[model samples]
Target: MDDQTDSPDDYHAICLGTAARARGIATRYVDGVYSRFHPFPSRWLALAAGGREYLFASGMLLLKGSDPWRGLGLHINEEATLLIRDKQRAKDFLDARGFGTPAGRVFRRGDLSAALDAFSSFAGPVCVKPNQGTKGELVFPAIADRARYESAVRRVAARHQKILVEESVSGQLIRFFFVRPRVVAVKLSRPASVVGDGSATIANLIEAKNALRDRRAVPGHSNIVVDEDLRDFLAMTGRSLDDVPAAAERVFLRGTSNGATGADSLGCRADLHPSYLDVLAAACNAVPGLNLTAVDVMIRDPAAPARHGNYWILEMNRNPGLTPYHFPWRGEAQDVSGAILDAMERGFAPVPASPPASVPASTHSMPAN
Candidate 1:
């Protein structure tokens, strides 16, 4: 049955409609109308019917005998890669697919000791983070001493029941946006610092930082007040409001921070570098189930991305922030919605029509020609 409904919430359906329109195909969106009809076998109810029987239909209802119910279409799907949200599983899957991903290990909470020992073989500080965390919420790194590592572990453990510890990596933080296997945009989040004049206090410096941040585009890190970590960082350095850093003195509140600081980041390196395609392809193959996942990758260097070494994939995002694709930035469309629609249409459509079986004489009288 042809269906048309007005609902902006159904992104998949909307994309299908948009794609169909772009391709010059006549299409309609049907929402909730299927429930109005009796749930009888489709073949019985879908027999070619007279126009009078469908007088109340919003659009033409294809009968089983002739139409075979193949016209149904939808916008999104449950099977898309968007459903695969786990961190370690995503990495293993990506690595198997030949994607240049980080070197690390995943273990259950009980087995963290062994995992830690295994990483000790490598020379470098290790980072500890929660398996599922928003932004850099539970991420900490560059920890060498065992006591500090234990402290960080305790703090992280208090917040989360489980955590992950891996080798510390030094590189540029880049977010590669993807829909399924396609890369749409590359955003480089550089760990940057800003200096303050001698006149402003540390508090005032932060306030000025926040004032310069662009709220409409990227939320400025400056707007985010000093957390416990920032406070501790300030205290350990023995600096207060009176001491002003050298003019344009670079001060880093976050060691691995690349996103917005106090000011909105300029589009200094907005374009995607040409070298990240191989890693992107490997990431897509790694998670076969994900429909759309943004792979958070760390490259030692972008100019020599591959030459530097394998790009470590921090994690694969399942439910990515969607606005960046079309709203403010007008990022490229992966057209994943269209792919979902195609899958839904093929999946939900009824079995194709076959030769009608010869039936016994009907009890009802047949009209004589």
Candidate 2:
């Protein structure tokens, strides 16, 4: 995960997925984890603009990674970084909206010592997460003490250009997928999810997650790390997967978003929610230029409904994935992609001019020859 670049596999998948739908090709989404085992030519990463870029992979981090066009799609992928790559710029926008976000303190490890005591003053249990690392690989959240917090910062400092100690909010984790002005899907995430048959152990449940190679296993997270935090949570609850965690019951993951290793996505259509729509509309106007983003939010209590009063905007995903936002099964909710593709094909709504003139300029200029 380079700061200036996106993971090749992640970028390539988006491009191919987008173009495949656009071109009417026999579309086949590939699994990234399994694909890595195959052979390929030299990998490439580049920036593209103004047209549909294409690449392949059901989506995974394949090492023998063959698809050479990964780099070529970087341009379209740049849309994703519109709100992410520049941390300061993103935080400033969120802070202006009256939403509580990570009170990120950017500093070198050496200077952090002097600022340590003060930083903890904002809130206790600050996290030392790399401004760039993926998953929870390099993030050290919950530094209850200053010494330990500083140490975590130093470790990260060795590798990163800067470190961010974010304010930790503990509660049910939620992720909201937005495509510009429209919020496609909002899911309440479980850090890690597994079904219980009243027999399998926690480890067994993990095995079950890993075993489903064909469908359930998502790329970038094919394997679950039964790290110390998970162990501690299991112990704290005085329970194990053997205790028969409720059917569709979630085993809580400590220090993570509902132990959600990406499974807690519950589809929500803000357009359908009246009260929430008001908030979304306000937010859209505030960030006028942003289109297509998945914003993470922490709703102290979400068991009720996704009505206003409780919604808080987290960071935005300029290029949110279409799969999670779309309905996976039959007849539940409208698939987000169907709407997005409809918009993409039917074309963006004609932007009315300020004076309501005879006709406004082309809203989305078609790609050049």
Candidate 3:
């Protein structure tokens, strides 16, 4: 079923549902319902008949099959899932467990001066983002100075009441998608980029890229927009969209590696260091009751240990989209969605109960249908 936080035409839900049906399970999309709250209208889907049904208001999956057997949404229980939604809270939990995360502080809408004060001691650029944002919205990867930082703060603060300011970490971005205790999929993620062919301007390259991107676009995927934000990002790098570069040179179109922003995900599960498996497992265990999580990490080199303290855990996503790993633009395809269903059929022992006051009713796990 579709929910407010997700698009009614969610491709992840579609792919997973198809996978389920291929295994003899039944599934179908629920009719579309409109709402003024979302930027655009969205819908939900469900299994027409099956062993059982689990309905959630925040996610797009409506599973019905294998009675008495249930799949946790992304293999994450409701409590831990909600806990990880707050970036600050999730960072605190991981930090306490000895998983090294970037040092940062949370600032409310009115606290710009304090944020600036905290940034003064940081080296180089800073990352500013909404505390509970997803799909890379309002996440500024690099705010180089107080002027830019303040501007970003004001812009981001208007939409999000809480903001996170952290020292910018530089490196290749990698995501470890874990299924329970094991790392099931790994991907190298990058901001949307266009390669120059020695003949076309950057703007022309972008248009060409968009042409191809639109042809393959799904519900969550999108064509890159050459908007003011992208122009500003280019200006900061001493370049312009009208500039042309040498053949094979790549120009990044945006700072955030969000698929909706046209970021690319390349499968790299086999390329990860062996040591990373254990370290990532520790990262997952940091959150109690969390069975599935996508851990964002940055590293200077792929051949070395990412746990050397220099590398940082950017964020944790409990309800991570699975299609990116399943059908990457480059690299090998992984069956991350299939793995999720596999974990669900295995069953989850009840977790230690969380305090009632800390839990929200809307975040409650659905009963088996």
Query: Highest TM-score among the candidates is held by which one?
Result: 3
lDDT agreement with native, every candidate: 0.48, 0.48, 0.69
Cα lDDT for residue 40, candidate 1: 19
Candidate 2 C-alpha lDDT tens digits along 5-114: 33345533554345435656333333222223233422322212223322323321121222355422222223334456555456665455544455666665566564
lDDT of 3 by residue, 160-240 (tens): 888898878887788888777677888888888999999999999989998987787644457888888899889878889
- TM-score of candidate 3 against the unseen true structure: 0.83
Question: How good is model 1 by TM-score?
Answer: 0.59
Model 2 poorest 10 in a row by lDDT? 360-369
Candidate 1 stretches greater than 4 Å from native: 1-84, 107-122, 191-193, 196-202, 214-222, 233-243, 256-272, 307-310, 323-369
Per-model root-mean-square deviation over C-alphas: 15.3, 9.8, 7.3
- Can you rank all candidates by TM-score, best first? 3, 2, 1
Error of 1 at 184 (Å): 0.7
Model 1 clash number:
15
